[model samples]
Target: MPIVSLPVIWIIFIDIIAWTFFHLFISAICMRLPLAFFLKDRLLFQVFSWEKSGELWQRLFRVKTWKGFLIDGTIFLKKGYSKKGLHGTRLNDLKIFAAETKRAELTHWLSILPAPLFFLWNPLWAGWVMILYAFLFNLPIIIVQRYNRGRIAAITA
Candidate 1:
């Protein structure tokens, strides 16, 4: 049987908007507050840290090929701006990149919340697709954040 049903697709559409908007709001709050600083010390952050995902294949994914054109194209994540806001030493960049990575990782974790909420509607394929899209959109950014953060951490350490 098909994973998604036609009747539930509309609910899935709304779920997608909610997923994105929720993260955007969370991102804004993170920018204003020191959530990243707090999360840095939390046990939860450890699971999402760079060390867990760092590997030969992960490095290969972050390479500046076609994938970079899509994820890093964002104005904020543009080029090396994420690590160095145009001017900063590698160690200083680590501090900045650390915070960025924390926020992205947090946002990625929160992205899955809406999927189960929508599952109450019927546990259809549409909800699953939204969850999958959330992963697709967030995972690359998360990988990039962790990849660069690892480099930054090395320089600072």
Candidate 2:
């Protein structure tokens, strides 16, 4: 590559590294943070809090506005979907589409990574790394949701 190209390559490399680190750091934070205090343990929050759910509903379904935004932001950023408005009508369809799309994307991304990197890099050690990252990151949130649900059920009963 030309000297001029070197800078561009360096920039791309830096960006990728930054992106990877950001994902890992955010995943760590999400996994570690407590969620029970915030969402009140609703079933919606519990089921959709993880990466798989987010990918399933948000990215693939391309659900309008809130659904898409929330799913993408949370899975990729370690946050939650908006609970503001009514989640009516096409909610189920949107979720299915998102899930399908997420699966495809995950497969594509995983396939592209170097297999040897799985052994060399802790983060990229295997495809399951992503799932582990998601599970741990979403655990705190799930716990919070479970607490909330118990409170709601008790109140209702």
Q: Per-prediction TM-score, please?
A: 0.65, 0.27
Error of 2 at 125 (Å): 34
RMSD of each: 5.2, 14.7
TM-score, model 1 to reference: 0.65
Which lDDT tens digits does candidate 1 get at residues 25-107?
65555555564473364565443453644543256773334334544322442222243232356555457656666666666
Question: Where is model 1 more than 4 Å wrong at Cα?
Answer: 1-13, 35-62, 70-87, 121-123
lDDT of 1: 0.55
Each candidate's lDDT (Cα)? 0.55, 0.38
* Candidate with maximal lDDT: 1
Per-model tally of clashing residue pairs: 1, 12
Candidate 2 Cα RMSD after full superposition onto the native fold (Å): 14.7
lDDT of 1 at 57: 27
Cα displacement (angstroms), candidate 1, residue 2, comes to 15
